[model samples]
Target: MSCWKYWPEIEEIAETLEGLGAENIDHIDELNKIDIEEVKKQLDRIEVIAHDKDIDFDSAKHILDNERMNKALKLIRKFYLYIGARLETENAQEIIDSDLDPDEILNKFHFYERYEGLLENESKLAKFNENKTFVFIGSGPLPLTLIMFRKKFGCKCIGIEIQPEVAELSRKIIDKLGLSDGIEIIVGDETTIEDLDYDILMVAAFAEPKERVFANVWERVTPKTPVLVRTYSGMRAILYAPLTDKQLRGFHKEIMLLPIGNTNNTSVLLRKIE
Candidate 1:
């Protein structure tokens, strides 16, 4: 959806609210001018309102007019949320302190996954394996990919999730399907932890933190390791981590736009160089 691309704008609006403070409603009309359409947009608004609860009121308003500073602040907040969600999903506990309900946020994330045309069938898991190791980042509905990758590829997997319920559900599904032997899921914090090596790192769209994580992994891995990333749509690798032919590892780099149903997932495969 176009909303995915315009998430930055929504985040900017949230920064405005962050600057406005909870009690500062003098300009509430100006803020109310923005239309409330989907859950994603509403969540952005809620995130800003939630910020007023903890942030100093005066400091929040002081930075209101500073567009650049606000933008940066939103990114930082976004990253924090990503880290918290990953922890919550992996550990099955909520880590972030926020006025916004974790259930509400998770629901919106699920809505995004449903709308993005992610996974639908079991056969897609044909490539998964229980022997080899793999990691799935940003479990925004693409954990289905992990399920399939594990089944089809016969590889062991660790799913790095941002929502506890989602992660739990994925784990349950794996168990129900009798595929638990190969999957080990964890929550990743962006600000901490060194990169963990894996045969592949499967990423999904709308995962800003995971995108950065991939770049971090690339910087650390030896030339022989391979990283296969998955994107929902758009010029994936080009927009995020573009690897040059010279920079590519000896393994291989592939750009694939696979059709799931009515939608398509554009994924880039970057193998490590040995």
Candidate 2:
């Protein structure tokens, strides 16, 4: 019996890998056909198969490492972001309605504390100082990064949100927290950075078309300015696409920070080559 007959889930993932490698068509269409929850289930199965000594680990590893599988995984991550953006919109309201302190809510998410420590360590290595201006791309509805940066470092921060509803809600949250003076939430995209001045640039984890954003930043921002990119590697690859080796070639300085908690997500500090 063939693997497809015995292991349908594995075959489904294999088929997705083949499909991604065969075309350069609309990724959204391909993404629409996939169920994020289902994909996670398939990935979980693959992980188990890869570790099972009785199973063919080498064969499973080959399929997992296939170039096409990586591409398909990236598309799945895009789908995840698409779904997450909508969820975040609802979550923002939930946070607002809960009557909990915004700081307490942010701390519950662990990002505020994670970034606080990450930035502190980065400051020592990169000679970073407080009070610098920060512009966050794809700041989403919560703008946790902006709030954290301003609260922790006393930095001036601006958040660019492409979705009008998310931008409005994020502003409301910022205002409620009385951070309106320190953090500005603008309704815009990556292009918004072109007209603004900032000492540091932060790329959100869900930001798409990252290559284009990087190119735009290189063309518009000063070479001395540092860009902090939140990306996934290792097991987190299921949720986010990690920056590839080729992507790191453009930056003059690149430092990969330590992972936070159990999440496979990490930050990369980059500076444009002069």
Candidate 3:
């Protein structure tokens, strides 16, 4: 089951969050005061809710909709990811300084197993091993998805991160992982779409202003190049951005893969007929 922390205390959390708080959670000082174990516990609790036989999807969704619990849930996830990125950067730098193998640290990452599960589901729908070039937006400091794609399929992976410092850190960790040759990280935002040439484009769930990013890619990406948007819905929409049918109305082909609770985002693939 999916367990999100503080699922029961959503009202208090929501009150703590200011306006449009999810977008600015990374810089929230009060959130930083939250103990790491507390964050982990909350996430664990959230995951378990998804698997509770007594709670159907609709019931869980209703809970989130009550008192705008969804906002608090999303704030927790954004905070979780931001803290995770910072922790990864610190630990990775230590490993690099020691000149030790980066494998152990990478393999033990918080979302390592979750990412593996996501890729398994993705490969079932997309051509990951057929020399496909993947461009992942909002790779953050770890760029774990791009790294996994390169190592698992031996395919070329390009990560476009909006934060320059995060992109620089991603490059450092990737180089330590000995994947610098296979993965490339560039610093730019949604407008970077015009500069990339890839067979597959994947947008990260955490990428902000999701609508504008989708629109930018739609306008500039090559027709028929499959654009896979990572989204969430139902109760899981609390953990990530939700995608609507309205956002994907004009695609010639549309496919959505539901997560089995081990992961967060639902992969939505859209292709233009050209």
Candidate 4:
């Protein structure tokens, strides 16, 4: 959907994916029709350019700064999130149903492998035992991260979601899962991070305007507080926009762990610069 009219070279491609979206296309629909393979081919190319081992971060910025590719990535990102949202909402509802086995429904999720890696590696990435009140921004409608954190780590979590309806839905899911005591979903946004006294702060991959959010966090949080920002790179950036190191100027990046799975998020552990 980028530069269909302005750029003749990209016009044919943009016009092809003109209707790429969730309302028109279900997540379960075969992506082959959307030329996903072609899109992936381009992403693989970008992955090579951005992560050639010797290339500096500028390689990635080159892709992000490119107006044509960036626009297409953004459009595809929205479509991807829409599909994921629908699936998660459906799964949440299924868990809420008294007749359905929540375990059965959860077992169908493709993220078990990913979350298990997180469960095993979180301690190595960040300190969670010192204090357990963790606040997660952009927790979404299902709050799966909070659920997993509470269940696995015995930690308490507060989810701050910008959308009121989505936060309410997440609240329902937590209650239905009988985890109300360990997790709470509130209707708020990035700004909410400042008002809460949390042992740790986590920014989800979907949180918008990464630089602004991190700046706000830097200005508001106490000195030396732990911050974990979930980021994506390489082909993963086709879905979630990758964060540039420049965006995190006020934080000391302590440790980074890239998990291998569908969740393939790079967990960047940060501490506020004193």
| TM-scores for all predictions | 0.43, 0.70, 0.82, 0.75
lDDT string for model 4 (188-246, tens) is 77888767878888888878788888888888887667788888764455556778879
The weakest ten consecutive residues by lDDT in model 2 span: 1-10
Candidate 1 has an lDDT of 0.46
RMSD of each: 12.3, 6.6, 4.1, 6.3
Deviating ranges (above 4 Å) for candidate 2: 1-64, 67-79, 98-100, 110-130
Give the least accurate 10-residue stretch of model 1, judged by summed lDDT: 232-241
Candidate 1 global Cα RMSD? 12.3
| Model 1's TM-score against the true structure | 0.43
Can you give the lDDT of residue 196 in candidate 2?
88
Q: Write the per-residue lDDT of candidate 3 for residues 1-274, one digit (tens) a residue.
A: 3334436555454444433344456565655555556556555655555435455566666666666565566565675566566666666666566655688877877777888878877876678864778888888877888988898898899999888887888888888888888899999987896877788888887787766776777787766687777777666665554766566555544777877557776777778544
lDDT of 2 by residue, 38-136 (tens): 544554554443334343424443434667566555555544455455445545676677787865665565234555665654454333236578888
- lDDT (tens digit, per residue) of candidate 1 on 33-125: 433233235444544443332334244433443565445445434433443334334322221333455334433443334324444322232
Off by over 4 Å in 3: 1-33, 51-54, 67-71, 74-78, 81-84, 87-91
Instruction: Give the Cα-based TM-score of candidate 4 against the true structure.
Output: 0.75
